[model samples]
Target: MTYCKVCSLSGEHPGIVLDEQQVCNVCRLDSVGDLLVNYRYTQEVFEKFQRAGRTEGAPYDCLFMYSGGKDSTYMLDKFVTEYGKRVLAWTFDVPFESEHAAENIRLAKERIAATFVVDADDDGIKKMMREVFNRPAPRKPGNYLDEKLPCVSCRTFFVIRAILHAYRHRIPYIALCADPQQILTMESDVRRIVRGFYEAFGVALADDLFRGELEQLLFAHDDELPQIVFPFIAMRHEYDPDLIVAELKAKGLYASSPMETHCTLFPLLNYYSFTHWDCMFYKLNASSHARAVKRNGADGARSTFSLKFPRSLNVLEVEERLRTVTLRIAKGEGAAEEHEAALIDAFRELGTSEEAGRFIARSFLEMPAVAADMGIRLT
Candidate 1:
């Protein structure tokens, strides 16, 4: 009854055994080692930034996505002061971004002479996100499973918006503070970058909502923005998280309280993903609190994972935020009841009912999940 650790398929299930690990024949032949090689290649690509002198550019070499987080702040400072590239700091003001994050955005603009743009269509964005989260996710059979969350959908929109901004503004490159470890080996190809959106939302979703803008944006062959580069990849060669955080803090750029994130839907999205998917999507992310602590010398032992829905957020606050988001989405989409009920049911399923609400409130403070119910497709 032994099962493969990688795929969790049965040992008796006719697969080639490799190194006594009993991987399925398909998986064995798939050459997982190739992924490591690809990662190395991706790492090399990032290292090239270090060799290329930053002074070779104008006031700014790229547009940096500034989330007001430690990584982005540090990277922004490094690019401006250390590398000497004039950067255009861009922030997407989604509905749920914390007030502190907004302040940090102001601080970043004042601290750096970088031009700033904040896209604040809170109502529209929230509506789009509610639909995105509620829609049925297409099943990707036999592949690594993805937990669908409003956050993923929200970030996809941000990237698209950023790309559109870059294309229109003629910004040569768009810089993301995404760490190498955070990106998958498969995502090295730029083509696959938007595949998740296509896969999850489909063409209809784009056509119906984005007015074919997303499709046109994705298909346009020319004038694409600069490759998304992770300066941290190169920094990894010289700096660990501790050094990076310290340097940023010394510069008066630090992670803001209540952790206003660049992405608004991260907390709720991560909460759902962790509970339902058995995947710590945020934890896997290098910028996640756990990884931040592990990499940046922050207190790793402390649960900085902020989406502790009920516990981290006061009951009143939770009710208020949910009510606000629900109303916004409802007004936009005319489907407030459906979305609200879904949220309530999801929370209840996670034992957020009054009786167990307090106990389960901080459950997401650590990753939490339900026992295996039959696999159900979540759109």
Candidate 2:
């Protein structure tokens, strides 16, 4: 039950090897001034993007992946009003989208002036998810779930689409509205990760856009790579998650915190990652927030959601920290209880493959076993 005083990471996991100082590896590995270096580099990239407007008759300067979340909503406005980039905003609606998130999408479409597009490619989404979810759980959870198998597989699918969309439209930029935690991750590894994704999938997926066409985009030389944009990183934008959520709500651009704002299946997904993988994916991002807090005093704007330590680890306890952030969500951003229904019920409604559904059901059953092994009790 040891916790890093700086970042609040548990020592149960391998990556969280806490030293005698009670500081986790996350804080220990953070090189001084890396954030500043990243800030300067991304700023320079943004400047080049500003100067490299529209690839010589290109329809738009950037193809922004707008999830109708706070970050994308704010960035959509920033690109149009401030950056003055002709944006083609794209929303890929997954079946498990939160009720509030959908409403936010509707509101944003009205307020944000951009060439908006929605792709509820249920067939595509489910097909890839089935492939990802149906895979056998590893015998031993490696590196404490840091690999984030499910999240990575799903994201690579969308990233493949983004690259394909930008290439087809001749757009030079694809903007990913990642939070600072995500922005802080190894940005350089993205190409390798995407390339490995394709390699792992092996033969073609037998789906549109996911076939072999993605290879050209990802496999291209560094100079030939389509411009990828991380808006928060590029601008070194001040991050205040609570403030962002409040502003969006005031503008009628949001539903509420947690449940309706983020993906409905978020809690379910994290549960699976924890039981089967021995770690939660969101912990990676939360660690980034922990690093920020350690370096910068708990500035009001920088204060994260309450990510305090637990007496021990279990589903409910770890899930709380996971909720502090999601994909594109920062650590300690929103309220909890994002979904009320049993996670199994929600998965049944949207989940496609029977085998994948069964895996999830079994995973939930094993949660107690996982906690028991660690001498922790599930509530």
TM-scores of all candidate predictions against the true structure: 0.60, 0.71
Q: Write the per-residue lDDT of candidate 2 for residues 1-379, one digit (tens) a residue.
A: 6677776667765445778999876677644377667667666766787787456868888889888777788778878887788999988777656555677778888887899887666667666665655566656424534446656566666776777777777787778877654544435333664666656566566335365675575566665456777767664457666577677778777664432354544444564565564456456545545556558646621423222212122333444444333311222222323421233343343322344334443444443443344332222
List ranges where model 1 is wrong by over 4 Å: 1-60, 136-145, 185-191, 215-225, 255-267, 278-379
- Each candidate's number of clashing pairs is 9, 2
Task: Quickly count the clashes in candidate 1.
Answer: 9
- Best candidate (score: lDDT): 2
Looking at model 2, the pairs that clash are 305-332, 324-332
Reference-based lDDT, residue 366, model 2 = 40
In angstroms, how far off is 339's CA in candidate 1? 23
lDDT by residue (1-379, candidate 1, tens digit) is: 5544443433332222434755454345464476467656656755654454443334455778888777777788777887767688888876556545676677787788678878765554655665655545434331332454555566666776676676566666677776544444224444455666677667776556455666555676654544566565444445455565566667776644322333334434544543344332332221223223334453332222223222222222233344444333423443535554544544453324543332222222211111011121222
- Using TM-score as the measure, the top candidate is 2
